[model samples]
Target: MSKIMSAPTLHHFSSLFTLFIVLLHHSNADVGTASRYSPPYLPSGCYGTEATQFPSSNLFAAAGDGIWDNGAACGRQYLVRCISAEQPRTCIPDQSIQIKIVDYAATAVSPASAGGTTMVLSDKAFGTIANMSATLINIELQQV
Candidate 1:
């Protein structure tokens, strides 16, 4: 004789299966998607120069210990991409912005306060990649 599952039991199992499928899809998607790093910020002070002197259309980011490259990293460049963002907004997919390191941020002003973000973008830089007004956004950083 075969035993029949109760209605409630069947419903519960269905819900679990749906959840499993969703989780599996997300996990597989993650494999092809670039991971996003958090705690991004827009620095108040950068190189003590006028903003106009900097490349407005291009992207720019702040560095932490990496900036202490004995002035070597001062002019280094990188390719930045918005991978994810907090609620009310999401990263602009596959958008790559080239940026340069123009400033240095202390650990105090880095990740912890900025949500553990190692790179800080300038206002113009952030605006180009994000449509929101938030000061922080997740990004993919690559040295160039």
Candidate 2:
């Protein structure tokens, strides 16, 4: 006589098989597209002294030069292009500035404004160029 399987054993096997198939389906569903998440804050080439300055500091630091007077004003209009090292082809903005690039921090942390990019400026530079009181400035970077 052929051996027969018990009902309980058959039910257990069926349950295990169903679980395995469900797991397989779930794993397969995750393939293809990436999960949705917040887009990165794109870095730009046109950084501003307003975006990079700290209020408490006495001077602004240029990325390429030495420290500058915290109260100095730009003698003429200047332009810079903002580009991201992470995304070289992606240009954030294109524009010109009359203000000089001065010494300032590239990033800041505060209780009110926990995290953001930093740009330092002299009081005069800030007043002459932008109405922003926040440490960061929205600037456009143009290719020279």
Instruction: Give the top-scoring candidate (TM-score).
Output: 1
Model 2 lowest lDDT segment of ten: 28-37
Instruction: List, residue by residue over 43-109, the lDDT tens digit for candidate 1.
Output: 3234454455356564665655534364456667877767666646656666778877766655323
Overall local distance difference test of candidate 1: 0.56
Tell me which residue pairs clash in candidate 1. 39-114, 39-115, 111-116
Candidate with maximal lDDT: 1
Q: How would you encode candidate 2's per-residue C-alpha lDDT over 14-67 as one tens digit per residue?
A: 999999998887321111100011112113123333444322332222221122
TM-score for all models, in order of appearance: 0.53, 0.25
